[model samples]
Target: MAIALVLVLVVVGSVLFHVLSPWWWTPIASNWSYIDTTLVITFWITGFVFSAVVLFMAYCVYRFRHKEGATAHYEPESRKLESWLTAVTAIGVAAMLAPGLYVWSQFINVPKDATEVEVVAQQWQWSFRLPGKDGKLGTSNVRLVSADNPLGINPDDPNSKDDVVVEAADLHLQIGKPVKMLLRSIDVLHDFYVPEFRAKMDLVPGMVTYFWLTPTRTGTFEVLCAELCGTGHNFMRGTVLVDTEQDYATWLEKQATFAQLSTPAKVGALATPAKDVAKVE
Candidate 1:
């Protein structure tokens, strides 16, 4: 009797705790509220199964208790009971999987108007690149990476000249605009995750991955590396600022383009030396 009461108490306590728990998801800042819905559905299905199983156990303990001189009856498994269990299990599994599949389908189907932004990840830092006036990003190769070109933008590519480069700085996005994020890693594996956006993707060393999101409001959000790249994984952090159209444009204008970054060094190296200038005069 005591065991049955304890089992029943466990189920009650769990349900109460779930209802009263203050630690729930942070307020969603993006347009992925459906993701929250899917999660809640999963929780409901699992919670129901858990409560039912525990309560049933409690019933069995009370009904089939070892009464004085009660003879134990043993019987082979019944096909009818086996069939019911199989059907119920199948339904439960399908209920949990269907929503996830639907969400994934929508998640990857990026909009045509979404702007492309490249996110380059290295150990303990983050960098970003955006298209300039041309509205197109240029090609990049890992082999082209150097001290002067950390992002590996192809110097020979004309399109790369005007590409805006931001290294180890905050990324700014125009609110209400859709953006497709291109992810790449120069070193070990990493993941770009923003909790408010409900979006994340892995950055592989040799290849690029992507995801899309539309900033619904203007605010600053923290970026975190969801993958363990090395000993400094915890220190891999970044900031994303969502701004209005004018604010975003102002920020973009202040960033240095690839051509601008390369031009100063080239001009300095080609400058006439003081001795050469004196002799020429």
Candidate 2:
């Protein structure tokens, strides 16, 4: 009796906590609410199965409790009952898998007009690159990186020369525009996750990964690194600012390029050969 009462209280308390909890993924802001709905469907189906099975077992335990001289009865499986249970299980699995695959399809196929942006990750920091007047993004490589080559910009590629690189700055996007993000990591694996967008993808070193989302609401959102990179992993945070077209354009204009920021005086000083200069003097 005491054990039963304790179990009842525990169930009630857990239900109340689930219902009253303030914590949850930031309220769905995109069309991916269907994902959440599908998840809830799975939850319900699983919960029903677990509760029904346990309660039925409990009922059998109480109803068929060993009474003095009570005889035992054994029977083989009933075809009708087994068939019904199998059918129910199949239906539940179908219900869960169908919607999940549907959502995954949508997540993979990005619209043609979606704006493309690149996110570059390094040790404990995040950077971004946006296309300029041209709609193409230039290629990059880790081997070209050095103190002089901050972004490892492909010098041979003319298209990369004009690409705007925003280092250690908040990424900006225009509202209602589908944005496709290309993720690259310079060092280790990291995850680009924005809870409000309901989407995320991993950034693997020496490879490119991608994801797409359209921001329906205009606001600043947090960009968190979901993968464990190093000791400062928890501090790897950035911001995503969604704004109007004009605002986005204004923000884009403020970004400076590697060449533009490099001073001719400094470049000449670094490029001068020591032996040639000494002979000239």
Q: For residues 84-157, could you state the per-residue lDDT of candidate 2 as single tens digits?
A: 99999999899889989988899889999998899999879899988777777878898987776666777677
C-alpha lDDT of all candidate models, in order: 0.92, 0.81
My TM-score estimates for the predictions, one after another, are 0.91, 0.85
Clashes of 2: 0
Which of the numbered candidates is closest to the native, going by highest TM-score? 1
Clashing pairs in 1: none
Task: Give the per-residue lDDT of model 1 (tens digit) for 220-251.
Answer: 99999999999999999999999999999999
Off by over 4 Å in 2: 1-11, 75-81, 258-281
